[model samples]
Target: MTYFNDFDINENIKKAIKEMGFEEPSPIQEKAIPEILSGRDLIGQAQTGTGKTAAFGIPLINQITTAPHVQTIILTPTRELAIQVSGELQKLSKYMKIRTLPIYGGQSIGHQIRALKQGVQIVIGTPGRIQDHLRRKTLRLDKVRAVVLDEADEMLDMGFIDDIENILKQVNTDRKTLLFSATMPPAIRKLSRRYMNSPVTVSINKSEVTAPSIDQVYFKVLERNKQESLCRILDSKDPELGIIFCRTKKGVAELTEALQARGYLADGLHGDLTQSQRDAVMKKFRDSSIEFLVATDVAARGIDVNDVSHVINYDIPQDPESYVHRIGRTGRAGKSGEALTLVTPREMKHLRSIEAEIKMAIPSHAVPSIEEVVEKQQQSWKNLITDQLNDDEDLSLFNALTEELLEQYEAKDIVRSLMKLNFSSAIGESDDGYNFGETGGAKGMIRFFINVGRNVNMSPKVLIEEISNAVGIPGKAVGRIDIFENFTFVEVPEDVAPFVYEALRYSRINGARVNLEPAKPRPKRENRPRPARPSR
Candidate 1:
């Protein structure tokens, strides 16, 4: 959980990371940033989405000065990756007077030459285009501090290895060399061994199975309760930017509407949206105009926003890979992040399967109470006030009023009163709000009382068989079944309870007509007569 603030970096870089909304460093960033900043040549083995860009980019931005000359060159495989890398660098160097130019094949070479002559501080481009500049004698690496081979494997596979070597040969001395690749194939390794100086290798497994900086948790909730659960989490967490992943386009639309109805700055992205509509929504999300983005997996493919503080899986992902990809969207840019999932009882097994795939256990949490949400909101208010006071430097303007108030009232009482005034909606909220009422049984189960039990030769097996047949579900779908002489308590999945109740109520089970309904807490003691013991 290394934060960007923990780094021995300058205020300009710190301000840039903050503006980009990175709260904690990703695992790669945590392991690699320090090594890179210490002036060590490093080899990073990580996948594309593992925040490798910032892992290398942050250190480069921190070390490079505004001396009006290029200090680093990042070589990527494609024009797309080159442009993407350049965009991320610009964001990281926003507070510094640093310039980054993306030179690639499709773009005008003359334009790149012009930007280069104007003294770009960092240049990211495909190896081929960089070679073009070198051939034209328009690019100079004499003063470069570092050479980053980003996606080294991809560049090699795209036949840029020769060009990469030629370009690296120019700045082979007195410079740091960072090589990042998803896989260390023989060719890339040979090149690393040839060019790099005793590099310290930091490997964040190529699959990126886990986002170590993102806190992962789940809520066992019913299908109907998911939207409200998400809303409550949003209130409690108050993320700066969030992405809620749904399993379908319809789910995205519905969740987006629900959030928007509750006054969240939300928009939806799905297969149904036109490209223009999606671009608009993404623009809003990136610019902080929209606080949340509700999206389906396919629609969220190219999303690379760095400031997403939270990733909420409104529906649990279908597989472990999707889960990893979804949560990886947060906790980037050296910022701590949160990942929340809502799973129905029936989906718990699937969730467990995903957990097994990722080789990690996801802890379950009870839904936040309205009281907790209010407390979080009040804490946010406290932080807001504290930041204002700290930044003001001249709080003497309010010293007289504070002293007078302290004289009239106790400090705790005065602060509490002020908090109440500042956040009336939160202070006035009733603690009894959002009582979903005795969830019938455990997290994802609903308990039901069936009037016929042991008296009619009823047993767990018989009850399971009858219920499964009646409800068209598997026998294993029923949870715990407790047989009493006259009535039995049965537990079933939450979303299926209504169907079970409808199918079994006033219906014959084991030759006796039975009544069934959702049970209250099991009776302490029953003082009723037992019915005749009958056979099925």
Candidate 2:
């Protein structure tokens, strides 16, 4: 329970920490910060979400002067990590005027070179990009006073060991090195032995499971049945808010589409989305406008919503560390959460690896049956009716009709007919059809691609509002929304798709011209053609 003030933290850093709402140091931060400040090379073994970024960032900022040359270089495994770490460092150094830049791929190399030429004091970069800069002679490490290897093991797994070693060799040998990793595998140890000076090691909270408050379970099914299995699980659990993790961007997009077709309120997030699109998705999730968010591991890292009730692994992570991070999204702040993984028979070995890494076994869960789903749906329907009855709505108009019907028909028959109709509309189709994996929705909804998205400040709400106003369709009937960088995809009733398409053919968003067309199936990697450059 050591507070930031307990240490000799700089006043500006303390102010920033307070603004960030950090009341106390995490175990890793408390233990590693002091060692790092003492000018000692250190090895920190802690999983994600342990506040490791601040553990190194604070001391690094404190030790660095406003020198023009690069004084600290941090290497990460992914662009997301690079950006995340760089952001944290910028906040920590906000009042100190220390320049922090994140260098990674998927951005303009020219821009990065220009930034480096302007003399950034701290560079947080992926190993490949850092190597690229070093080879291009655009970056010099001659004055580097500290080097940090964030998620060292992940870099090793990604085959960046050589890049790491080469970067280390270029730095001054006497510079303090800080290595933080979730696990110290043999390769990681070898890395430490070869590069780090006699380093003090800090291990935080000794639990094998990163998320001890999560209930972990897995379901075994055919790979092709994953979508159906997910639906049954969703119907059974009905989490207030949940996250579904897919392995690839394409997987994320496909699962999101499939779920929406099944009438689930869901959306997808991945790197292909513009920042505005990502922000809009997150805002909807936080506001409960969307009940489920399907995303890839990299895309999900920025999610910080507190009430995530469940984390569903649509694909098993290839490595144990990723599994820990995925499930760790829930069960936060000591709240009880659920983690469910859908596993195919072929992926049992991968599951075993995850179990061993966490030092526990995940119990097998049966796929919820058709009867179970029907019962769950029925109960939900009853709850909805009860809620409506409790509402302050005038029912005098319905009372006369009810009385007339009661006089001619048995009350049981009348109630049964109403229940049947309610269930039919609520569940969209019969339980038998759902159990057999028949997709449900408007039955004739067609998806169309619109060449306007969040880049033009488009959101699901705004898009629906515009379409309904322009095409004279109710906003509620507007189907799933998937917005990308420069375009959008929307579903509407097939009968009216043509009408809506024609209506929006000359639409514009944010003063930009709009294009409407039927959505072509996204091409797979092998068959996809090279994209033409966007017009200026």
Candidate 3:
């Protein structure tokens, strides 16, 4: 079971593996393949980029025959992963001439129907699309022998659990089912308990969950200034291969466009990409042509690249585990890498959670300055020039031209002009000038004056607890409390202000109507004559 050759795989599958240039099996494949080929249900706990597709795919494809019905269904969380898994399956089944179809939303249903009519042995699709096909009766699971759920946890996160349950119900309970996820959440465990029978559980250790070499870091920045800060960091780090993680597909597209407009060789990877488009983008990324890849969490899950130097979190991930996975792209193969996360003030709690889970403190760092970016660029150019000088090449013509120019102008002048031409134009506007407003700094606290005070039987402690319970703000961030006859004033962190404001805007406090607004500046107290030098 340590090798794929140990299994009773067909010749065509072996040939396909050989053609695909896969000789040794990955750890997951080495362990899970044999169990799956033995017709046992499996629950694999492993991260993406671990070759889980082949672990489940090879056995499933080997089981597929010349039957016209769909014998295997692979469900993925996103459309991009669906197409990617289907393409891998097709490649793995190439020698057997197995027919595989990818079905997902945002595509023509009629086309899917036509392809289904043509008889696909395997169908890879998303939950919503698969449910649609099931409703239309365009897909049949009666003959299905194997079902694979890739990134099952992600599917649950997207609220597709019900659809997944329905799809599993449609499949034969006696058939082999495989569920793979990075983390085993409670819901997934419950599903396996209910649907799978005596399933063999294979768990890859968390140390091996992601590349250990990937260096991870996070930065706290205002949401409005995230783009500017990201550009500054990228300019300063200047990664040869990098990826920026966003939350949505639209975010990917927009960020990719913005990066490209600024002269970076970047591209978007998301569910919207066609198979061919995805291939092109990955090709560029692999060939070192594209330096920046903007992608969502699900779309970028399966990407395995060794040369990536940095990973940027454009949006603070919803979960701490996702942050780990997103940054695992870099620092691979014993290489030192960098990861940066852009977080807003409100999201600091999430950041703290990540730190608590990882058991490591991510040191806070300031965004790079424009001058630093220019210095880094110049250093890179200097390195490039040094390499060129060291290379054995015919530079007689260039040397002669340089000598001629040196005679007309001083060498320093010529170098200065050349540097200006090569590097000055590349320096972009500095992000330091970009204002995220006063809401960014901790100094800017939200001030709200309440109409309940000592006269109305109110204390700061009660008011603090009430506001905290009502708007979800902790008491620690609630600043100074001032009590007056008719009103009380309190300060909250700026980031939490908007939410507290909206929550209390129309709500009554202590059964009395209240008003919330920016706190008025406290009037300066004047010193009266020291009590007439008094009674001392």
Candidate 4:
């Protein structure tokens, strides 16, 4: 489909697309939307950047009616993604009358239940929270016209296969099933075969996965130095329009606040923000009022801009496909763009995996030193002066002061003094004054204490292997592992700590369920009772 109007979609959908600034369908949307509209089971193999959410959202919303029972439900792997899908559906159903609600774990269940009782037509949620509603009989799925498994592979990786099976079984057998994922692993394939009815697969070729116009590179920096390195890169690139991608909502908020405190024109977007708040932030970003937009992967999916010169990954993307999506925000509409990733020493292995899967060798580069950054800024400063001189603006207001200063000091000295005034505020912005707060571990690591150890046959090797398999992260990313007689202390990357926690909270180790929590500060040795000395 060349244009959204070319397809046999609802008039309201076309109107919403126009309002949302999209005139045409992406490759994935072009293929998937028609099949979905035809009421057949669909298996869409496309990443986030290809507009897969809208691909399914358009048809799903088009078919669903404002019924008393839920007519459509979308299952996403993360809370943020669930909210993103709900927001996208809200836009697509703007001209129509429909109610969409996103239910996830952190929010109060009573609030969700109250909203559910008000008769919502569409529900989007994470698997765990959806399961809670299912157990409570709050979600009515008997009238469901369609079911969408957004990011199927991500759900499988997060150990939600059983939950998915349970939820699918509750929906009526005649409903359409749609599964969208970046890759079709064996588990996801098995799932589709068992649950779907003659599903048609839509995939974008490898060549279309990423653009060649993007100049990609990676930098190895300690976790403590990530913000500092990002600042240096920002000063060096001076992108006209830039977006910084972070993985978690907390990361987005924290990074946005940090950049703002440092005098950068930056704002953040995440699921936590209200719709009006998101609109304000995006409006600022589009009109160039904000130079850098710090956002998560899903939150930035709908961002369509042509002049974005750079995309910085403050926290490395978890997958190659997500890397493609993150960088795709830039390099739009035939303009060249640059992308940079910051990796910790332990994350280099994961970075290599992304490189191998993406089939591109992201060259390594050192973070610009303070001296190098200053030199580049000095050149830029000179260019600014040249441009000002070319503008032919009158300088009579400052002429008398310049003359007085010129009489007191050499002309070169006068210029140097101006330089000092310009650069003094920004000097050594991160040298010793930077705050890298303690995260219960060494820099870049968050130490977690699991309530299972040698008592349940746990060992360092077993712990590392089990965690790696459970969370889909490299064993190296699991930092130092120390197994005690009854408990264990393990360190993991700060960025990945949440995933580990979520994946392992209800998980079993050595055939016994385990509990995981952040390690509290160890008390002074004297605060503990002295152990009895064993007889020699």
Best model per TM-score: 3
TM-score of 1: 0.49
Candidate 2 residue pairs in clash (backbone atoms < 3 Å): none
What are the lDDT figures for the candidates, one per model?
Answer: 0.80, 0.81, 0.78, 0.81
Kindly list the per-residue Cα lDDT of model 1 for residues 116-184, writing each as its tens digit.
899998999888888889889999999998999987876776678889889988873899999998667
For each candidate in turn, the TM-score is 0.49, 0.62, 0.64, 0.59
Which regions of candidate 3 are displaced past 4 Å? 217-229, 247-261, 265-291, 295-309, 328-338, 342-372, 379-536
Per-residue lDDT of 1-536 in model 3, one digit per residue for the tens? 35556679998899888887777887789889989989899999877656788999999888888978888999998776887788888889888868999998888999999999999899999999999999999998998988899999988988999999999999976688899988889999999999888999997753554446656666655455567678878877778788888999999988998888877899999988786788789889989888988999867855777788888889888887787777767765457788888766556657778878766767777667767777878777889789988999988878878888988999889988887766653565544322223321227676676665666666778778766755455887788776766777777776566546655555566677676665555435733122122235
State which candidate has the highest lDDT. Answer: 4
Summarize candidate 2's per-residue lDDT along 1-536 as a digit string, tens digits: 69998888789999998887787887788999899999999999987767788999999899888878999999998776787788888888778878999998778899999999988899999988899999999999989999999988778877899999999999977699999997789999998998888999998753433556788998765554568778888888999999999999999999999888777899999989986788788889989999999998777753556689899998998788788777777876457789999876446667777778678778887778767878888867788889989999998989989999999999999988888775543344322211211122335677777887767877888888767755445899899887876778788876556456655666676677898777765534535323345589
lDDT head-to-head 1 vs 2, winner: 2
As a whole number from 0 to 100, the lDDT of residue 92 in candidate 4 is 91
The worst-scoring run of ten residues by lDDT in candidate 3 lies at 526-535
lDDT ranking from best candidate downward: 4, 2, 1, 3
